[model samples]
Target: MSGAARQSVSSALPRSVDVAKVAGVSQKTVSRVLNDEPYVSDEVRRRVLEAAEQLGYRLNSAARALASGRTRSIGVVTLGTALFGPASLLMGVERAVRDTGYALRVVNTMEGDTAGIAGAVESLLEQGVDGIVISEPIDEGEVPVRVDVPVLVIGAPAPFAAPHVVTAGVGAGVLASAATDHLLDLGHHTVHHLAGPQRWYAARDRLAGWRTALAARGRPQPPVVEGDWSAASGYSAGRDLAANPALTAVFAANDDMAIGLIRALTEAGRRVPDEVSVVGFDDVPVAAYITPPLTTVRQPFDAVAREGLEMLVHAIEHPLAQPSPAIDPPVELIVRASTSPPPGKPREPSGSTTSYQA
Candidate 1:
């Protein structure tokens, strides 16, 4: 048949059968190539892909799921907020999923909904997702008795025996300690804290890390001012912190709060680093652009997502095999201009004594 005649007969949305015919291969071979099944020769796989591309053929995911009993898709559930942590984690997961040739589905949940986590899971399952990922689980008090599929939780531990992954928040204790120690090493008498809401696991972990570092150095732990992970909250906390002349350094739970705190302190006639050094968690995108670019802890979100995808993929591929244990990625502290030695103090020499008096 002539090429024009064949084109006229082809469906606008080409199918596997059309690709097989064009490539002069069996429909099963087309399936194997589409699904990345092993044993197909390189030449055959290349021919199949080229044919599919030329014919504008797209794999029918639903039909493939029916035949293989797997959807080749993963679902993610996260809070319905524009918070930096959850949003960045989601983006990272998406990049990893696409790289692995899997489809993604995401669901966002609100607080205080009676149908919270359970409802989100049901919706994903109904859509035939092979596995589910809870990106950030708040303390909702609802644990699944048993999910028939693999599940991975980020930030908080899974309520059941499912696998989990840790973002920066998991190691917040150590991260906070490191940030505090940096300020202390700069000759600050004592570092104050601007904490996130107490209800959040991230906030709590960060607070604990800060406390642990302070206690280790015999420095007094100041009262924690709570913020709602908003710049406004940080500003309010900053105001309270600025009033206290004793506070020479501040560690905010996240960058937003840090920004607010800095603004408030600046308005109060206090110079950052010169008067009060500030450090924040979550090296957000805008951290460097702001004046005196924020010195903060950078979460390895890409690493966390890549790890979570690896675990979930393993569980999906081997339902009966045991999944790997949760792993915590290492976090980095980016020292910027926002922090420095307190006024009237020179840089401390190695093994020098740290004076607690302001």
Candidate 2:
């Protein structure tokens, strides 16, 4: 075939019959050549090969997978709530699966309990998913080891007991540390932390990072104020933080809490970044538009999800591969308008002092 004619043929034909027509051979001969079925004569095989090359015909992966007894579908289980991190992670998984020409069956678990997660997995299995990716954190003692298919868990590293949990690496810790350091860099003597519930891996890692950053600077780790990953709890925590005139900078574990903290501080006549600085994690969509845009850390959700899915697919394909415990993606710091140095000094206690407002 002439170069120009071959290019035109390649652009126009994508099926075996089209290649057969171009090569002037039977479709059966083209199929034999494609499958390496040995019955074709040499001349016929050469014609089929030239035609296939010219036509740029490639075998369909779906047909191949079906014949191989492998379903090209993956199951993804995640929280139903539209929280920033989980929602973003799900999107990333969908994007990666689509890029690989695989289908995804998403199951949203309303809660993070073992029963709920297991049920979601079961539903996905009923749909014939080749592998599963669980987007919820594995509670301390709740890893599932008996599922028949390969599963990838996408939270903090579960204990050695859990078989194939892949976590977004030091990203969470890096985020927490970056927020703390930002506060410190702004001349805050110490950064107080408002942590999330201990049951969550993110909560624990963030607290550890905050403590480590503070300790490295020889600053005292303030008593932790725990919240339930809710804005209400953050608001209540903020009330107590507002009482101490010396409490200059605060690092809330998530952006919701940071939003509440800012509101509480404003109500108490404390000016953000003037009287005190505030730093938060997650860099949620609304973080930048709040009263004073929040200074926070951004998680690499796309990279994390892509890695988690790839790991699960690998595990599903090769059941005997040695298990790796965790995977962590990197994090970046985002500087906004809400964080700055502390005010002059601690104000003298007086009738103005208020106890926990909640």
Candidate 3:
């Protein structure tokens, strides 16, 4: 037969029958192969594949899902802000779902309200999602009262009371300690902190880490300035740091704040790295493009998202398995041009005593 004639015949045939006929097997065998059921021989699998290609047969995902009684869909709940970190995490979750041949159903909270979160969760459940991934970072006290399905909470530590929840393994303490250690290693006597909102777990844990590192090094803990994870708040905190000439190093909780601090320092005629060194967290996209390029801590958003989804799926498949929540992931410091030895100050001998300098 001519190629064009063959094409027309192939196009006219039904997918299931085409697969069966090409493989010289029954339609039941084709269905078994598609479903990955046990008892299918390797030779039969190869024949099925060749048949599928020859007949232009594509497995009907909907039909397959119906047979399995699963929608093969994952529900994602998030604050829905376009902030770099949250947005990147959402993309990562979507990527993981697609790669797993599952559909994604995203539900965004309205202004991070608890009611909004509860509603979003309900909606996902109503849609018959097989699992849920909560992308927002909430305090342990603020977690939803009850979720009927398996859930994975990203950003915050997993709630111990909730066995089904999994958190992004990255702990704020690790990020904070890494930043503090970097500044300390650069010969700064101590590192000051510009913190995020007190209610946030990240802010709390990071502050704790900073203090822990300072204590371990026997360095005095400086006063902390609180910001709301905004550039403006950072600018305000930066102004204070600029006035205190004794302040040599700083670690801002997030990159946005770091940018603001840098701007404030510049306006005050203090040269970054020369007069004051800065470190930040999140290592957002713009961190590298900033005037001096920020030294920062990098969060593994993609890995967190993938792990969270996988955990949720596992919980869905075996609701009684109840795995222990993982500890926060480790954070690494990325040293860059923004940090260096403090200017205009000579290092004192290790055991030397000096009069008050500030």
Best lDDT among the predictions, by candidate number: 1
Q: Cα lDDT of all candidates, in order?
A: 0.75, 0.70, 0.73
Query: Which candidate order results from sorting by TM-score in descending order?
Result: 1, 3, 2
For residues 1-358, could you state the per-residue lDDT of candidate 1 as single tens digits? 0000000111134668999999999999999999899999999999999999897565544444667678788888888888998788889989988887779999888865636767787677667777788765467665553344567676675644433222222356677888898898887778888988877777887888899888888998888888999999999888888889888999999999999999999999999868898999988999988987888987767876787687778767865566566555555778888887988987433222222211
Best by TM-score: 1
lDDT tens string, model 2, 173-240?
Answer: 66787778877876788889999888777788889889988989999898999997778888899899
CA error at residue 354 for candidate 1, angstroms: 22
Lowest lDDT 10-mer window, candidate 1?
1-10
Per-candidate RMSD vs. true structure?
15.5, 15.8, 16.6
TM-scores for candidates 1 onward, in order? 0.74, 0.71, 0.72
Error of 2 at 154 (Å): 1.2
Question: How do the residues 164-235 of candidate 3 rate in per-residue lDDT, one tens digit apiece?
Answer: 555454566766887798778768999999998887666887898899889999999988999989999999
> Residue-pair clashes per candidate, as listed?
1, 4, 3
Residue 218, candidate 2: alpha-carbon lDDT? 98
1 versus 2: better TM-score goes to: 1
